[model samples]
Target: MAQMTAIKVRGKRSAKPQEKWTSGKKRRKNIAIGAPSFPTFAALVDSTALNRPDQRKRRRRHICLSTLEQLPTEILQDIFDYSANIELAFTSRTLWAQLRSQHVYMRLTTRILSRVLGYEDKERASSTDLAAATRLLGCKFMTWKLFRSWLEEQRPGVYRNTDQFLTAWSDLRPSMDLVPPIKLLRGPWTSERLSFLRIFSRAIENLLELSPPHYEVALSGFAEAVTEGSPNAVGMLLSMGLAPTTEMVRHAVIDSGCDKDIVIAILSHRNCEGHVGDVSTTNVDLLDPALWSWAEKVRRDGNEKGEWLTRLLRSKFAEIAAVPDAEL
Candidate 1:
């Protein structure tokens, strides 16, 4: 090995010199031959940072994929509701539970509905007012289908078999009469005769995983159920007896557009799907393996049979459309 000699240069040509160390009574002196500026911990850190390879600007980590997740759950929920996303209950089980809170929806709806229906005071709703709101909306069973069981004095055996079913006050006539100004309302009116209370009540309540029962079959009222490709909503619709056919629905729940987990949930629902009702079918219905196999085929074969499996599940609305109300 050859011995290298230190060469000193002036100005920019000079290499940065190594920091010199001296014990006690340190004083400024002439620059050493090749000695560099004394480095402090901060200087070292800064140099280390400067030398590091450039990295892509780091993204902010959050509970959810976007920083929008950092906002208060209520505000996030408001965003979810105001935007095209409809409701979070259809998206995340955790977030839905935290944010879905039918209490809030029912609270706001009942308040607004009560005010609109001349039954509530906006500033301070009394217990009586709250009771009246609850009575009018009738969410006692938490779902309309369950309420129906109580109403008709019927066993839920038939409904429970399919797993879909809501509340009505005995004193209040069924909303079919569209009492008062409710009939004069907007184009989005449901198939049922909706009062202002019914409309607001249903709108608020539907911000849930499963919407109130009658609303599910209403023309165009089921928008939240089908919009933005919510797997929970899809599953709920199927559970509620919505036809699972591929034509009008594939656009809403396909893998290309929706979260994979949600699509999986929708495809895997067995009890809720119509395939189980078919006496002639020998194949197992909506099993994960079968559904995944079809999905894999779609991934491999390119949409050739992508939507074929969807035709197997039945939707409640489709079933209703297939049958006349008089017959129903």
Candidate 2:
């Protein structure tokens, strides 16, 4: 009887705990079904109003989101006043007025133009000014763009006032002793521009200094203009440095249309050098029809000295064509 009673007590205690757990589960289920679930926190947040950035007022209360474009012209002009000076920035009247009115844009364009012209100080510029300069210089349609292109092209009339900006300046030719060795300007070499600079070179000879390299450049340009076969070209070459050969000398005489004084001066220069081969030492009477009579007269006058005239005549000299007579 005692053993059976103890077992019943143990079973009653375990059953009581299980019964309590079942009663708690039933209560929780009843609450879950009966009670209405409130809106989630996410839903609450979603339902509330959010003020967007665009809805916020800009440029003070005067320039509202609704009537920003309808703002007074004077006010607009004042805003972009700096950019107004740049022709490229003010494309339309309304845009010009708007940008001109904005203090930021106005200051920006002014600073940008100054920087492109290399006039503005980098450190002193504001963030707005630097940003404006960057935009203007980089934009293809901007005034700074066109200005740089014109400079690179070396176009005349575009920078006519550039001469006035000079405190003191001289080119590399004559001022070599005075001027420091440095490159002042360089750009694309168009034939027309090269020709123009060649003339400029001559004009500035008195004011400038020519280093050896500069002289070489000028000489090369002159050489390119005239071929060796041309008499005028030969004259120019002789004037520069080349000495005349006896055959060359005689050829010049026969080709008297070319300036003889220039030839003589070239032959006389100490720096002039020449190689008159035996084949080119000949004085040929038949070389030029016009010179035939003079050759005969020379032969007749110097008949007794026949060997000398024969020695003077070289077979190879006949290859030179007479140059058209050119005035100095």
Residue-wise C-alpha lDDT for candidate 2, range 1-328, written one tens digit per residue: 4555434444434676656644656668867889655678887776553345555546564433335356775655554453434553345555544554234443544454444233222324344444454444334333323433333333333433324212111221122122111111112233333322332232222222324554444344333322232333333333333323444544443444223343333333232234433222233232444444444565687642333323223222332333322310
TM-score of each: 0.23, 0.20
User: Number of clashes in every candidate structure?
Assistant: 16, 29
Off by over 4 Å in 1: 1-135, 138-223, 253-258, 271-328
Measured over all alpha carbons after superposition, the RMSD of each candidate to the real structure, in angstroms, is: 18.6, 24.1
Model 2 Cα shift for residue 16 (angstroms): 99
Name the 10 consecutive residues with the lowest summed lDDT in model 1: 176-185
